[model samples]
Target chain A: MIFAEQLTKSYRTKTEEVKALLSVDLNIPKGEMFGVIGPDGAGKTSLFRILTTLLLADSGTAVINGLDVVKDYAKIRQQIGYMPGRFSLYQDLTVEENLQFFATIFNTTIEENYSLIKDIYEQIAPFKDRRAGQLSGGMKQKLALSCALIHRPEVLFLDEPTTGVDAVSRKEFWQMLQKLKSDGLTILVSTPYMDEAEQCDRIALIQEGKILMNNTPENVKASFSDPLFAIRSNKMYQLLHDLRDDHLVQAAHIFGEDIHISSEVINQQVIIDALQAKGHTQIQLKQINPSIEDVFIKLLMHTESHEQHS
Target chain B: MNNIANNQREVVISATNLTKQFGDFIATNAISFEVYKGEIFGFLGANGAGKTTAMKMLCGLSTPSRGSATVAGFDVSTESEKIKKNIGYMSQKFSLYEDLTVTENIRFYAGIYGLSIPVIKEKTAALLQQLNMESQKNVLVKALPLGWKQKLAFSIAIIHDPAVVFLDEPTGGVDPITRREFWEMIYSAANRGTTAFVTTHYMDEAEYCNRISIMVDGKIEALGTPSDLKKEFNSATMDDVFLKLARNAKRIGD
Candidate 1:
């Protein structure tokens, strides 16, 4: 549903330049749940802003639903539901009023799109009389989503929709998104949460204005080329600090109580002795599968190494 | 594991029959929990599930309609001033002055928390060094990356050396790598005996906490260590555990 070719965005300050997005190429299939996973300045928001026709790209071309983002800005806006990272709703207005206002802007009534957003709208409908500002963060998120979907757009662009929400609400929100996807709406979501990346049918791992990898979550995780281990001891805090400082342990960091490590030197016994010497007794070390987060961490470490070598 | 309170590990914050009502709607149902002296306690729920309302009460920003909460040994209802003095907060948006330089913003927040000049200087210097962003201290807050800004905001929030630090989704829009780094900072703070009460929707992030309370429909539905919750919910992951509890969707127990 969305295609971009060498797209880029740059902002010129008085003193220097800020390249928010670099030359990027992406193709998202229609009705697919696509996720853009990245850190803050990885250009996820910039890409969304450009694809939704809210911001202009510095270079390259992007086409949404076969219409050029720059040439068919209004048409793109009409067909896509864009919920920005920030809450951009009428705060003073009631939940129902905000929905009505957004519906009115699209020349549609809330009753018309009521069926589309029924699941989400129903939760906030209890507080329909309450002002948007008075509602909690999760309520505002649902209301904003209802407003976005009120027009029954073909594609939904949710920029970090689950951020700052509670765990239950986050799960509930994703369920709503899944239902929307099953109903044949092209869903594009950007999130910093690595676990949420698995929820998407496909995801593009982005970092520092560049796409590191783009594929199915399973395939992306499958590409991890490292021997991973989870180690822990009574002195977990001290052990973690010591492990990270060890030369044999690459990517040594805490994951829960266990310290996740890459067997960089491949001398397990030597590493264990080093840990024992560091006063980390009763240490438990076991080979483990890499999680999506672990895979990404390894990828980042590899990229850093490649950069240093180059 | 259920009632570790009597062990006397020094409970910093304790709640009894904590309830908050806005008119007929109960924002926080009758709930009670305790936070240890140095631990990261995660308060999680759907949006509008009363996480912020409960947080507001803990931060002394709002009063509970019923129940009682003692934060840093001060009554949340009566001794709000003392409570505020001992606790620092960083919201999701992380309200820093964009127009001000990074150093200036830190100084401003430090002043608001009633810190001395020498203390502020020492804390700022140590914070910048720890974050490895000392060179960017003179730059305006707007010029830094969102990750750096979030880290700085967190650094400033706890700069007062408060007893408790409440972080409401402090790493919301940052990247996964940065989020991991952010959690590192949180862990360090918790290790120093500062109770970190955090609220977030990310389930994996929830797993990182020492203990998490899952809220649904204005009430805490589940609370335990991640592993225990996962096992109890018969789920392999935190996400499944959350979905199972949230849907109220008919579990073996339910």
Candidate 2:
């Protein structure tokens, strides 16, 4: 339901230019939950702003629900529900009041679309009297979603909805997204959290204004062709430091309790000795399938090396 | 780093029933923990679980309504100013000035911490070289990417070499690679005997901590090493442990 081609945007400072999007292209089918996964300053928000018609792109074409973004900006805005990175709720108003305000602005009433947001909105009905600012992070997010849905938009765009929220809350927010998607609404969510990429039907890994890879999470992980190992010992930091210095270790990164590594030494025993050859005990090593994060890290390094050479 | 990891470690921060109340609400309730010197301590909680409230009490920014705490060998309540002098604090909300150059930001922070002219000069040069950002020393902080800015902010936060450093979501939106590099920086600082009290939402980061405390409903519900907690909760990952504990929380904070 959303399509874009060669979308480009750049900001000129006093002495330099910041390229926010570089020939970006995307095609998200109807009812598909697409995730744009990238870190900060990776053009996630810039692309969202362009597609949402909140800001203009310097070049390229974007169509939302078959409507051109630039020419049909007003229609696109009316047909899309957007929750920016920051909570854009009315702090002084109560939760119900905020929903009413959004509905009023869209020329619709909350009652007119109560069926669309009932499942999500009812969760926050207990705090309907509380001010939007007084609610907790999770509650505020729910209220924001309710307000965004009050107008019954065709598609939803959530940008880092769970950025600073705790682990449980982050999971809960993603669950809400899944429920929304099951209702046949097209969803485009952007987040820096790579783990959340698995929750979407398809994901586009973006970095430094370019799309690194666009595919299913399974396909993305399956595409990784390497002997990856999860290694750990008593001295994790020391082991990491030691491994980085070893000539055999190509890349090593701390992943939770284990260090995810891709090295020349495929044998587990030889690799253990290569980790400084001593001082680290209780060693654990296991060959594992690549996670989405592992694949993204590899893609990022490739992009960095390519940029350096160019 | 190995020799310093021995058991005879110093206590940099200690708390006994540290609590903060605002009117009828108990923001932080009787949270207790101890941070050893040169150890990375992760402070974790669900939204509204009182992590920020406890941190403010520990940093001497807010007075606790009950219980007590000590940071950097100084009592938090009675020696508020002294505690402020001996600890470095950085949060994602406010950091180095975006309009200032990298070196200029470093120099300004050093001056604020009461460093001398020559000391600031020497530290500025060393910091730039250490960060491998000598070429970008003159570039405005805004010109730097989020990862670079976070790294520079971290360096400046510890420029005074405080007894302990508090990092609040320091790597929130940073890429995975840069996030690991940031943790490496924390490890190096801990190696240098600077205790790091880090707060993060990433479960993987919680695993990196020597020990972490998971707060729930204004109280520290779980506190131990990553492995111990995972074992105690009978979970495979710190993320599962966090979900189990925080799932029962009564408060949902920002």
Please give the CA lDDT of all the candidate structures: 0.82, 0.87
lDDT of 1 by residue, A108-175 (tens): 99888789999898887878998998876678889999999988999999999877665666767888
Interface RMSD of 2: 3.3
Q: What interface root-mean-square deviation (Å) does model 1 yield?
A: 6.9
Report the number of the highest-TM-score candidate: 2
Give the Cα error of residue A200 in candidate 2, in Å.
0.6
List the DockQ of the predictions in order: 0.32, 0.56
TM-score, every prediction: 0.85, 0.95
Q: Give the TM-score (vs. native) of candidate 1.
A: 0.85
In model 2, which residue pairs have backbone atoms overlapping below 3 Å? Answer: B47-B253, B48-B253
Tens digits of per-residue lDDT for model 1, B1-254: 01122345888899888899978878789889888987788888755567778999988989989999999999999999999999988876757999999999989999999999999899889888888877888999988877778888888889888999998876666655667678888878887878889887766667678888988767788988886888898998877887776666221110
What digit string (tens of lDDT, one per residue) describes model 2 on residues A75-139?
A: 98899999999999999999989999999999999999999888888889988999999987888
Question: On a 0 to 100 scale, what is the lDDT of residue A122 in model 2?
Answer: 86
Pick the lDDT winner.
2
